[model samples]
Target: MTKQLASSAPDLPHLDLPHMGQVDDPWGGVGEGRLFTGAWVQARGGVIEVKEPATGRVLTLVGRAEAADVRAAAQAARVAQVDWAARAPTARAEVVEEAARVMGGMADTVVRWLMREAGSAGPKAQVEHQHALGFLRHAAAMGQEPQGHILASVPPRRSVAERVPLGVVGVIAPFNFPLVLALRAVAPALAAGNAVVLKPDPRTPVSGGFLIAQAFAAAGLPPGLLHVLPGGADVGQALCADPDIAMITFTGSTGAGRAVGELAGRHLKKVQLELGGKNALVILDDADIDLAARNAAWGAWLHQGQICMSTGRILVHHSLHDDLVTRLAAKARALPVGDPLDGVAIGPLIDPGQVARVDAIVQASVAAGARLVAGGTHDGRCYAPTVLAGVTPGMPAFDEEIFGPVAVVTAFADDDQAVDLANRGQYGLAAGVIGANVDRAVRLGARLRTGHLHINDQTVVAEPQAPFGGMGASGNGSRISGPANWDEFTTWRWTTVQPTAPAYPY
Candidate 1:
């Protein structure tokens, strides 16, 4: 069992909440209560109160937007994209790079917001900041890449193929890892000369939306180029259905992703969906016990395991299952869980409802005859790091994605059984294989049907410079990192020139 998270972080170094000056001018004199919908207009939707998950303290307020607001935001982006796209690609790149520089100065403010609003520990907040900046710079680099090719053609004719912006792009980012998720698409789309209408989850509007807007605006990005609307499902649907918005890029749950994809398909617009995962971590017989245990603990408990790529299942060879389980459970118990501001390795869930849902899954799995190897309880939203042994396919812990700090362990007979166990689920987001034999581990990873496979690594790894995405329920076969951006945010245009008349038209 875990103790209730306290309001103060007495054990950690000195901490200060955001005072009036720290957050006073984040919106350039606009009150913290309202969202900046491109034109500095107020939101038509009702007020949403931002609360600290551990203490239930109201941190700030933001608007919950309605569908009309989304349409207006999209229209504004449509109008601005013309001028924005008309600029030189290098100039666009400079603006994005400059935004990263300006945002670097606000690291303290960003960390505080992440800690209070998103329940991120210090290390995770730092990682988020660095990754957000990496995405921005990577987008800038992409803008400098050659977008067109001179094609070989028949005599007396020249052919060229170029990729151009898809005009206005709509982005919906989830509350978890909002900064990285929102920027990964938004930066690339903007760098490609497409204006973006971004819908941040209402649960984390400030850290997810306003911070990015402020940085870009401060960097001299043209007004109306981007609109940040913090809203719920209706607003997301409206953004997808807007006629001017050419594409919709969304990051969230699989159910929500399906809805977004369906709506965009109905409208004949492109959509990129990054959704849920029940990632697996496989421990082979030849692997180091301590290292495998460490990887499992990190993959399962980081950010309270709310991440989509969090390891949900651990498949170990029967020879090492018992010993590996014991070590991993001990490591899970040693980690502290509390308020994010307290500088603990693990932190609280977003709210009480999430706590109930996670606990209920753990309980159901136990009732289904799975052994509770470590933790099976919570105090408020601070659920203890949990481990379950003897999990099988029919149990809730095995089938459902328990997006909490819970690890489920299952034993396999051999390499073939390990492959079958890893590939048993619908989610194909990420998986990891740990073994002393590097060649054998890589060969095994190649057999698993996941988008991101790590050899001798954990499931929680991500790189801004690599192509990151998934298949099956995890995504729609679309990717959103590095060069993948060029495909997701732009379309092809073919141009041809003929000095002499041909057989056609004459």
Candidate 2:
């Protein structure tokens, strides 16, 4: 059992909650207070009330979905997908493009919901909203592009390969990046002409799931093309098992990803997973210690370090280890930790449970010989930005993905040792190398076994057109962003035609 630590720091003063009328009803006045399945319909299950992490204030009440609701949503998607696919790709692109425009218009409301529901700080919320818009527009553009190839076959036959939409895509998104994660998959899947059954984390129904449906609907997408069902594990299991759902794209913990992959495998359905990571930041001796410290602080403590690509481990060169640790610790201590709406540098964890989990990890790491360098205290939902040194390979702080505002540092003797130390963990999600020599840093980054790497930058970075996903335990074979996403949401069919009779071997 995880034990909670008594907070040694004082709580930050609370900010006044926004007016209720300002928050848009995600249901859009369809069902009285029910889940959105084409139109608002009452779920067979009960309701879930989301609470703000900073103050524990009631954010909103949303309907909780069950297996019956999942089936209904899946059926609706199955029916709508055929017509959606029949439409011109350009027409579909127009709808998605309109949705992006709508999202841009509603940026303020969306950012507020993200901060309240997902504990995102002001800047983080804004970035997530912007990224969501960019992703939507990118998807719209891809939808209009040519999607098939023609090739010469034997003799008089012509062979062609065309990309076709998978019937229904079941999207299960995480709470950390509620808006962006959902849109990252949803936009691409919709652009490919597949209907979507989105099951967002129950914790972020309005920000993560329903807001997406509202955007598309406002953009003039036909009813039933996207159904947002917010619920728990039961809902997710049902979505995975539904016969009508042809594919599953999930973003969450590695354990949950494994379970989802196994379930999808049993059904022989296509699945794309973007899971967790214990990312690392390597500081070479040639790096500027102050610059490295600032970048490391940003990557390790941003959004309370809830990001999947957060730098959980810092491997510094032996020569620079002491100086880097001192500078990084100072940076961590100075970060403002408070309410998300208050424009604080760091914010609360998603809930008390998350607070306890993070504290427990920190306590255990300290017990295992890791030295606490600075800020290992919590106040209410907020955990102070923390830095730990003397972390070793086998310690939990070094080996595990501590998803909090805490980072552990260890020293490496040389370049080869740094690479080995970075790759020793099971995760291969993201990494960073900080050095004055860009070429040397790039060479070292190439040797690291991570899916994405940065030189003289932080691990937590993403672009609209970058191929984003992980290898090994961090994710399965499928990737999410850039041109790579097209293959995951679509299937290729080879067609051959012979105008005239050709000699047949048979």
TM-score between candidate 1 and the true structure: 0.93
Tens digit of per-residue lDDT, candidate 2, span 1-506: 00111121122111121111122243222223467766666656767777789988765667888898889889988998999999988899999999999889887678777877888887788889999999999999886677999876785778999999999999999999999999999998989999999999988888898788778888998898899888889888998899999999999899999999999889989989998898989999998888888888888999999999999888899999889888878887777888776667898999899889889988898999999999889999999999999999888888888889997899999999999999996889999999999999999999988898988888999987898999888999678888876788899999998887767899
Quote the lDDT for 64 in model 1.
Answer: 70
Which residue pairs in candidate 2 collide? 31-40
Return model 1's CA RMSD, one decimal. 3.9
What TM-score does each of the candidates earn?
0.93, 0.93
Positional deviation of residue 234's Cα in model 1 after best superposition, in angstroms: 1.0
- Candidate 1, residue 498: lDDT: 92
> Per-model C-alpha lDDT, please?
0.85, 0.85
Q: Global CA lDDT of candidate 2, please?
A: 0.85
